[model samples]
Target: MSNENVAILMSTYNGEKYLEEQVKSIISQDYTDWHLYIRDDGSTDSTVNLIKKIARDNEKITFLNENKPKNLGVTGSFMDLLANTKAQYYMFSDQDDYWMEDKISATLRKMQASEIDHMPICVHSNLTVVDTNLHGDSLMNSSEEHWSDFKSMLFANCVTGCTMMINQELKNLLDFDKVKSNKLYVHDWWIALVAAAFGKVVYLDRSTILYRQHQGNVIGSNKKTTLFNKNEPFNGRVIRMVKITSDFWQAYGSKLTGQNKNYVKNYASLVQHRNPLWNLRIVLKYPPARATTTGNLVFGSIVVRDYQKLSRLG
Candidate 1:
């Protein structure tokens, strides 16, 4: 693989503590044919200075939006990075996580094996969950029975951006300008939806990166479950899920296929209908395939019980 074929995009914001370590891990990757693009999202700390110093030493590392720090949030920063860079393959990087040596090579291999001519494809792997000190026994597996289904992806996203490598075809399909930052919940979820709906979402069941869990993490891994938290109130979880689904539908519903469009439309409209029975019927007809059976049951119950309240709030 040529250096120009692979681009790793990292968006940094107040990640001074772990940024250097993470960058070092990338620099030590077994796959050396890759370029690193770092964009600072208005950091108050020495993150920019650190990046500049490192870029000075390494020719492959390039700092983006230097000196001019626009505070595009996480999703916006990543979308901006994606929009600016062109490559045969693109990988997203988080400043806090450490990549395994073979992370790039393994993910690229899987992507190459799964590629189809002119079709958008995204390949992502599981992560080894680690604490701030990079110690952990658990794995953040990125697999669900129905994760590849468009309807399932609308309800829950199993893809993690830091572990993802998307091809040029998938990059072309992700139009950042079409969907505003607010409506798009997260960049990874939006990309997963696009891959599920239009092309292929290939999941590699192996761990590729050290997924660091810390206080400042925008999104963290949960050892118990990825879809829903058992401790949170059922209605609150259902409402949040509904809102995200509605946002996804509002953003890209029109671009989906006829069946998927109706599926998303019905799911997003659950809060609009106050009738519990109607909501129950909809849930029964088009159930979101959650990771676990308990999740599906809880989701169904909450949608039925809180339909009226959800409508009132909306």
Candidate 2:
């Protein structure tokens, strides 16, 4: 290759069934200034061997073995890979998903063109969720506003990890060492939140990936599995609520850095008090990013005139 400007960080764990197809799709990209920085997290199958076979012949794909005595899980694997890269642009990839051809080109264009490129703006796209057999089942879409930067950055995950493309500064800032490095990372939720606080988050709605969902997924599908599906619930809604609220409170209140620390503190406080006024203010105050937040929190409905204006843009 002539150069290496983009670094693709992919994390794989027991993904043999779909690994080859996904890897082939990545290699088929129209863009040439890129390399696949991959780490296979102790697969018991021939998945690592499959990667090693192709990687041996292709210099662009660098296969990093887990040097750790134990598997670091997905977050630690990414941390390790992120530290090892020196590319201008950084992205995270899921093992089982196939990216659209224009995915990187579109993200790179927006990133290179944005005035806030120095800041972390997450350029994401719409994803079509598919079954194991690659049949389209649902749409795992992107956020319309900058809220994915805020809300996802705050409590719950609003954006999918696979559809994201972040910048260099964004990568450096969110890396564990830059700010709040000591906290345990629940994969990329903290990283996205930090990204929103520091940079602008863009929603590129073009469908750009085939996100495959199966029972083994860390965060499985929202719907029940089909015929072979275990489709088991994580208990009832109330029990799920208990854990979710706890996670939100902790992530939001934890000693975070940059602008989010303040926002998180305020949010945790508001939710603790069970106040409607806070959401109302959030709805009224933040624009573009918090449209849904406002509509859901503040007035049950937006002012008709404002809603109509936003609708036209959509």
Candidate 3:
């Protein structure tokens, strides 16, 4: 450990195309005191070779390629890399994306000062996406204006991975080992749901990177403008969401009790299938709208009548 202020947890799989460039951008950051825990998911290509070369060449870069015999896929590989970091703040990184110079600095500042607990997950920022060489807004930041923004976490995900930075408060609760067992989801949704359950999630209104969107992504960038593509229909979106929310409750059920569990189950339903329970939640609690310092509370308690409502799964 070099007494760094931040550690970047990066996972790669066949990322030779942009791996060198991404590494270059990180190494060029003005904030020099940081460690990068880079791991390859048993890539057969030159990707692993490049990582080895990088580890040999740079002191700040540390490689974690010892994840057993076979590749762990995306989620498992990332989790394996993440479990190896020990920094005051940890930020998730993808193989193809490059971070802005101030990315770590800005997120680390907030993490150190944040009053929230690890139970609520972590805080994240906005992203500016790049399509091929041209750039445009990912339009995720504008999600803050959604009608159901606060109440509709299940309906849509507003958080982006490149923009995430977790504090020690969150770090303590996040058993990186445990996430590998939760079969579904990329790391972003996992963090968002966990954080929102315990407390409010703060969104920094800054674009942290050039979120390169391409067809090669395991889960392509969730940019608003890209919705016109027919392959990216909304039917699968709702189903994938339902699965994600349901899995969250199932995996972390024991950690929650009391109204928190009730709220999570109810809220998850409200989000996954638009179960009328959300509106009912507002009625049962007898408060139309209540505000917490960071997140607002809508207490509607309508029992879910239909459990079989189906949607096209993503």
Candidate 4:
């Protein structure tokens, strides 16, 4: 185990085009106490070769699974890195994004300030949405004031992985075995849920990175689903939400607070009831918190109208 205070975990797959630039950004960070761990997820391109070359010149960088690259997808690759690395603080990185020079120092400062003795803590920040050419657009932040709450996190995730930092206590609570069995939506959402339930979630209102948007991005800012889209049905998104929530409950429901446990239990039970009225009743009685009143209403209406379809999807 390296004595570095922070471990920067990055997973790349066919990211040869922008990988070098991202690595350079990490190397240029003002905080030099961090170590970079890069895992190539079975890339057929020259991404692996590029990483090897970069790691050779930089002692701070470590190429993980260098001999055996596996296609574990984004979530799996990140979890794999998390399971193997030991550090006081951990941050996830995307191969295509550009981190600000002060990204690590700023996030670490916030984490240290908020951390308690052996209690889980996660610190996340806003992102500056940018194009492939690094042109900045609007800042991306959570619209929901209570986004760190368990109920809000269960339904909608505003935490972006690239802008997140977690303390060692929070990292220790992450169970890779449960992660393998459950239908998790993403690694970031799971971390948020654990932090919200067992410890504290701190939000930094400032942008820490240039969140690059491009065609190859697995999940980009522009690709997010809006509450209202004429062509897209709301059922798909709601169904995914139910699946993720149910999986989360099954994985960690026992440790949740009494109120949160009931909230998740009732929400997860909606798919079990055959009658739309019954499902609607449950949804009405225990609605998940949303950013706005309109959003809450829309989400409830979708569950009521498409209960059968949502159930089937689940």
Candidate 5:
């Protein structure tokens, strides 16, 4: 871990409120062989100035696209950072979250121990959810079963970008063009999907960062949401999944193994085909999106309703 070099990629918009705290936390990290690269997404506030102030004093902290900044959303900004940076290992960071002192060192150690030679590897850990004041709200435990299957990953994302670290092999495999065309939900999910399919996805049980939840976040953790909305319609989600799945197949299907390719095709069919039996068959063949049995059961029950709607249409 001491010999390895890491590049931390962060995307910022109107993050002036918590940006300084986050930057200071990274500077205070116990691991010292890392550089921070931050890209601002056409911020109207003083976010750019704040990041520029930090970069002026530190050689390792780089402010990207300062002269001609483009308003590429959060996903696009991160993708831009990913395309340009090179390092032995890469990490994604949010502009507002404060990391634990040993976060990088701990995750890097885990990656080194579990890494397979010549294969893309990624390691991510649990995060402690906190409020704007940095008060510990709750814990989002990601210590469940390994989510390595393509079918499971197609439906849900278990890895969060702020807590993720990827090796050079994975970095080389990233296709920026495909992500830009596919309208990927986020950079982290795409990376997680690739790691699950092509290499190893390691999950560390310990919480390593203070994940701040606020109104300005692009995505927020929902620890307090109700279990299931029985009346919620699946039509909108199904439509979005169809487009995403088609785009994904067009982009990365050639790199997938025979087994994974078959699973993705079948899963895509289950969503697109109006046949109830195909849905039932797919449900029986592939495990649910969630890893636990009870979680899978609950997931299946909701899908059953959607399949019933398809049956009625047919």
Candidate 6:
């Protein structure tokens, strides 16, 4: 591989158990022209010490914010990393996942083969779900390679940060300083939405990382069943969808193109409008924003005030 620089941005809290293994995987990559930039968010455990040990042995691994570490959550920590790091390509890493040896090289190759000059591009691949002990679990299916429509991106976020790689062009365009902590949910979802709107998103069919599923995960793999009661009536997903779209418009409305801005506005109205049935009306009038037919049907069930119907789709 060429000597082009790639930055691996990782956030660690009290991840003493799997942190060392995750860092080792990065060191074992086939492509060696990469720097690991890690930030510890007020970890009182041995996580910081482990990172320091690695840093002492390897010059490429830099521990960020050793003096006065801030207690930003996962999303905030990643946002800080994105703002400060400088690289030709960037990849996000979790404190627990074990990446395949060729993960970086494969993603970089796909990114390079795309038309770099025309638009910013992001490449993400499927992941193999694994248990806490790194035993092989199940394969995660890949979504469609491209999501050009802003409306579809608004309702669902299929992109996982651990499997994502982005060009510097897309990185430069994000206004990280202006990002409101309260409005944003996940850093990867925000990046995916922006990339889908202003750039290109490519999905490689192959699995690139072993996504470890444990009890402490902030967000679990899609294949994992929801921790909540299966028959629960209160629809948190609907509420979250409303908030995410609304927050995105509040944060990035001015940055979006006119067409994308309109799509955001239309989706926002479906959630925020005073009329309770406005969502159903929009679903009937506008083309379906969701990608899957089942997804559209489930969304329509929510719009038509049928929570039981939506739950049955599970």
TM-score of each: 0.88, 0.69, 0.74, 0.91, 0.84, 0.86
Tens-digit lDDT string for candidate 1 (1-314): 43437999999989999999999999999898899999999999998899999899999999988967898888889998999998899999999999999999999988888987878998888889889999996886634432577767777677889999999998888766766763456788788888888899999889999999999987675543345756556577567667767776776777877878887788788868888888878877777665466666777788887787778645
Cα lDDT listed for each candidate: 0.82, 0.60, 0.62, 0.81, 0.76, 0.77
Off by over 4 Å in 6: 142-148, 222-234, 255-259, 270-272, 291-314
User: lDDT (0-100) at residue 195 of candidate 4?
Assistant: 91
Tens digits of per-residue lDDT for model 6 on 1-314?
57679999999998899988999999999999999999999898998998889888999999987776898888888888888899999999999999999999999988888845657888888899889998985776635433545666676666788999998888876877676753478888788888888888888878999999999786676442121214444355655565677767776787877667876766566544545466666655554564356655556566567433322332
Decoy 3 TM-score against native: 0.74
Best-first order by lDDT: 1, 4, 6, 5, 3, 2
**Pairs clashing within candidate 1:** none
The residue-level lDDT of candidate 2 at 136 comes to 85
- Backbone clash total for model 3 is 14
279-307: candidate 5 lDDT, tens digit per residue? 65775677545446765564555455576
The per-residue C-alpha lDDT of model 3 at residue 64 equals 70
Residue 117 in candidate 3 has what lDDT? 44
**Ten contiguous residues minimizing lDDT sum, candidate 2:** 234-243
Clash-forming residue pairs, model 2:
153-193, 283-294
Q: Judging by TM-score, tell me the better candidate of 2 and 5.
A: 5
Clashes of 6: 0
Indicate whether candidate 1 or candidate 2 has the larger TM-score: 1
For model 1 the local lDDT of residue 227 reads: 53
Error of 6 at 272 (Å): 4.9
User: Between 4 and 5, whose TM-score is larger?
Assistant: 4
Q: Tell me the number of clashing residue pairs for each predicted model.
A: 0, 2, 14, 0, 0, 0
Model 3: per-residue lDDT, tens digit, 1-314?
Answer: 13347888888888888888888878877677888888787777898778888988998898876445357777776666666667767788888877788877776665555654443436687777777563666655575432212335544566776778775556566566555533666666666666666555667667777787887776566644211224555435544555675666666767876755665565355444544655355335532222232222211211233323432221
Looking at model 6, which ten-residue stretch has the lowest summed lDDT? 224-233
